[model samples]
Target: MNTRKRQLAMTALGVATLAITAVGTQGAPPAPPWFTWTTVVNNGDFMPTDSCVPTAPSTPPCRTFNSYNQPSVNANQVVVIRARSRGGQGGQAVHGVYTRDMAAAGPVVRILDRSTLVPQPNNLDSTFIEPPSFPRIDIGMDTVATRGNHQPVWRYFLDDVTETRAGTTGVYTNPFGDLIAGASKLGAVPDFSFFEVPEAPGTPFDVFPGAPAVTDGATIAFKGNYPVNGVGKTGVYYRDLENAPIPLSADNLEPAGGSNPVVLIANSLDTFIPGTRTIFGSTAPPSAANRQMVFAGFDNEDKPTLGGIYLAPLNGTTQPPLRTLVAIGGQVPGENSKARFNRLGEGVSFDGRFVAFWGAWGTEKKTLVLQCRTEGNADRVAFCNQQHPNGFITTVPVNQGIFVHDLGTRQTQVVAKTPADYDDFVYWNFSGRTPGTGEGDDDGELARWRSASFVAVSGLVDGTLTDATFHAAFKARTGILMSGTYAEPVDGIYLREGPGKASLLTLVETDMDGSLIDPEAVDDLGAALPVTEMGIERDGFRGNSLVINASMGTEETGWAGIYLTEVPE
Candidate 1:
């Protein structure tokens, strides 16, 4: 919605764009611009309404709190927010749809269709996740079993939400219907089912199946599949939404291990190429590339870990990967490299050529968005600078200036350097990484990016570091990608560097209600929005790129859900 300009205009794409603002005319009040808001899903009812042009002193913003988790829509334009009623609920709950301008009114909202995405049945747990389809959601839950090689299995449900939250796009639905009611067709391994675990004795296993229950209002998702190199996998896992999983096409479907990978994306959606190859050598077609339609898990040998950014091909993927960029890959944390999770943060170049992985381990140890160059070399394995921790050489802050790596020349230049860390003059400071589309970001033709920043952690929460999303080329305009501390609401926003790299973020100011990260702010990076999970959705979620955070927990209960936000362009 390029409604940036004040003049009302309609593009060829039927997307209505009009800036709304309120102002007072002495004793006389004039309406601003005519606008329409559709209450898609919420606690409200289906009642199309209208409102005169808002007459406030600033721009008018509308909020649609998540009523469903992994809210998905179909080509029929049906938007469904996945959800589950109280604990004792059964089968799929309400699934709402709507037309345009359903919320022209204030409170009451309307629905295009008011039917559950799927009819109640044998407790088919639909794990919601976004595929490569635009504005369309896909089910990460599995419908049938195939050769998944152990990657946290997932099947396409067309639309809905999953459990796991935060940066993890893969998630499982609560066990519904009859306990032990499912087919183990593929030889019967540890696969998900709708049968709710029994609470008493061994009746059926308490609560639902799978990991511990996610926290309320926390967005989470599953991380890796089976395993990678004998390491547990990680990906964006989030809860907290009324829906299931909302695939974050930017972070590269990866779970937490504390660090950035060495991959880049050319699309803002999941894309995958089987680890296996075809007898023909060229590999298989896109459809056959998945090998397993549902992601059950990955090879246990390659247990997934955080960003250990290395390069490996699917056992049977395409001959030459359509794309290659940094992604989570490591037997464990630190990847035995200088980059530790504490200072991990990065950016990828277009065309999957170069990667900017940053991290700062020790004191004299500053942040470093290590310039990882991957010039279409699939065999190229990313090796971190050993001098990282003990203070080898590279010492850039998460906000270091003029940081750009030119692949053509294989050169790393830090154009801008500050006296020292922002906190203390004796130390140097820096940062980088914008939440924009990692796709098509060929270093040759870079577009948008973010500025990673760190706040001086103190007291109990020693390392209270945060990442801010800024524009590429290190510009400080407005909007920054930063998380809020439990103390403050609306954490932070995408920052657009000014003429001199000065920041002008939106959340800090527009947060009229005090705090509560604005759900709308997640869409700053073009159609790419910050999601509960991490990863890239190059092909409708079939291929995800992100890191899994195993140490993550929820706001109230134990660890749950994943967290992600848009990077400013």
Candidate 2:
């Protein structure tokens, strides 16, 4: 057995012993109060047949969904997600964006899918390749916004023959109406007549990276990239859709001004990095609520120590300057005066009053050695050996922690940290397939990494800063190696209520009963499958509802799905 499996086996033995002793002493403790689990959607659930389109002879019928991305929940208990269906459609994977009203136990409704027509200018209909991940919904409303990759529609007359351009991606939204039937084109690229980069007049957007965020007021905030003077530029921008024309009818084919003007929030070339002398080199996708936006900015893209999170007000007549919420060099709360943040993650959770984020500090480091699990694939074995001649790869670890910053009070609260509440806050993995004998693909996951913690906050939204009732939900990986044996790390979602509270209530964790994921799922041995993996993006928690994606099973058989539960403050 590999090191990980061996460690799991040893940990299982210890846990079994503890369970027997606990039953004899305390006759089993009360179940966690936060686990009122409700299944949102699961793998193998049949998708809407209407979404399937037989474009090619090899195209098969769209059947059950096989995978899901992180989900987002709104205050109404509505969840918006992006999922993929595999196998049945042999030609290509069928991808789509969907929403469900968890409060009413309603059926899943499709917003858009690969077969759906891409609403474009002048009725130049196109089809989407896939709906990008991280589809978002407004907190107070159901306005959904996402980035869509579609067929290029920009056409030119070349030698009298119509030729289409290459650019084919842009931000889109479903305005406040029937999300499915009312979906319309919000903004798209290569069509300068309809969309242009703000401030860089006449320059059309090259691409919109990341999922767009929608406000309750129908304002869309996104990070857009374009070229200016033959050089590339990027910024975070927003467009007010309340007055913008909707392409729901032929008469509203285009905006009155030819193009809807997107207001610039910040850009890499001009926006000053708060608390630093250098300007912002880049900005992450923003989170907006209650007419305010929160985003992380970096003065040095290559250095995490030069980054911080800022809040920009969207209600002001003039673009208000950004207010520094936290910085990399800022003193960490409850730590020594000398302790300062050395790293800040790009993902943040903002609910108007509170901004929950993760950062790293301290000088202590942990090294993780990774060896490829070849699984008897000769190509993988050769690739791994060639990549790591020493037989292993190692990661340089830093101290990590999660924090909640109150915009009203201007106070920061440390929720959890490494070596105290968990072992590590981030993990690395190899992604993509091994290359063939020839040249290799530039897949992002060769040594890709992701943080284990994605935090969200819920508190009184009474427009007051003094409200002390703040609840934070974050993902954590705990357990550490002691002596020569490794204690299997427990990946879990936890809730920390109130500011500076050290105690955290377990919301969900690995090795828990599979009933929490799906009561009917079991392994081949006829026993409940234990929870295996959990996933939550930055926006997974909103209001009092926390939604997450989980995988359950034993080594042989398993299932994955999305689950929702209440986190009472």
Candidate 3:
């Protein structure tokens, strides 16, 4: 046993300080044979009638699956997802992109849906109106990049009958073969132009926001924006699908020494923001591996206290200057030394050499309120008391920390924090909008809070950097149950192993006990349905496996699923 007595026997069988001694111990907590769990697809199951399902209420296609997003895994355990169904046949909404292998239990393949087929120099008969709510996988193969929202397929004429312009959205791949018949098309956003950006050319990338990191040599890494005369620039690119150059038409563009895209960092270009002379006014959305890349920047994209986390190097020749790992005034390691870092998190969890991020320090807040009849509807509790004359709606709390860092020993460590080990890493709710109207509604907001952590990190590909064998896994919530004060929060999915050596084992929480979530699933008071919500994404942990998305009983014996476990060595 050893890693601090197997993290104190996994903190006495799954931490949360053993929820009041596991409320009279009866289930969950004794699973340490080496921890197994699996169940990669759930929410009424059924799908696969040849993928994407669809066909409405019945007939050949079937349907079922419901929802899921946040799954990636691939050190060969495969698993890549982004699902949504139930509504099919006519109420549309089938959405797809799937994969499953978990060492071959078979079934769940499908990659790309909405009836698949938008790969042509089109005329608006597109397919794929969705597939980018996280769908990546390639940490050493099963290649699966994604970013697809269809419909425009690039074509512009205007004076000669043939006009289509709406930036078709792109980035797709299947590279290592047979992942749903070798998927395809990997770059679009009107296929680069305004001279293709790279050293600085600017203008044609109407936006490609998230979902696009894939390396293990298939190289994809993305985040583009482009506006130019109306401001908005943003960067961080990369293409190299094993060498680029063949995209010419099916409206996929790139061809002329492979249409640019290898920039790595943009916004004003001098890049800066490490020790700060202030430069990158924006970046985030990148986390590749082996070909290296990790992002998160922002030296003032309208109020940012410096900015941090970098590391770039796609290795395509000249272009090598970003390497800082954590920086926004630094300090904040285990805290107090004047606790620095004023905010850093924009999703990071690289694996090339451990990066896992989330940082925030001081400005310590805590307001909360929230109560428009528990979350509106009487026209949002009378527009939340006509915009707060006090029916309730507040929110402040967000002091975070969840670090890892170690770019070959630059060292950083601390994997959880906020009021010294959990109290509020931000979490509010009640955004039953409809009150004033969307988008920050004149600041008298109705409620919205998030920063509930979310991390990943794994290590030891070849070990050494003082190899104690990393490992992270996150998604925290904790902060309540003061014995007699009674707030009782909990929420979980934690792992942490060799960062200051063990003590956060949990692996699933929020009233856990539905037979530790599936030992036959009970709940009509035959108890055992607990677990309410857990999720984890920043490419949901890989290599030694982690992959979550859960919700357990009651919307009528509820269940929602996607789970995989394995971390014990």
| Tens digits of lDDT, candidate 3, 1-569 | 01111122354234333232242376655443235577888866766645334545355456767667678887667788877765634455577888889878788877777777554334465666666457788777888887776666545654466654654456677673522111222222343341245554434565566667888646677776666667776777776644334354544432222344455454545656655576787887788898888888786743477777788788775446787888777798876799788777777888787888877777755556543443213465555566665534344335676888887778898877755556554443333236444311111224433223578887842333356468777776655534222176666666767657566666776766545545545655665566677677777777777788776765334666677876654
Top-down lDDT ranking: 2, 3, 1
lDDT of each: 0.21, 0.66, 0.62
Return the TM-score for candidate 3, rounded to 2 decimals. Answer: 0.35
Better of 1 and 2 by lDDT: 2
lDDT (Cα, tens digit) per residue for candidate 2, span 412-510: 988877666676666443433465431111111233222334777777422234686677778877665543223776777777766755355666677
- State the RMSD for candidate 1: 19.8
Q: After superposing candidate 2, which stretches have Cα over 4 Å from the reference?
A: 1-34, 51-62, 89-91, 122-124, 156-167, 178-194, 243-258, 316-319, 370-397, 429-452, 460-466, 481-487, 554-556
Clashing pairs for model 3 are 56-89, 120-250, 121-250, 481-488, 514-528, 554-558
lDDT of 1: 0.21
Question: Model 1 over residues 488-547: C-alpha lDDT tens digits?
Answer: 211222122212333223211112211122223222242212212111111111111111
TM, every model: 0.29, 0.81, 0.35
Q: Lowest summed lDDT over 10 consecutive residues: which window, candidate 3?
A: 1-10
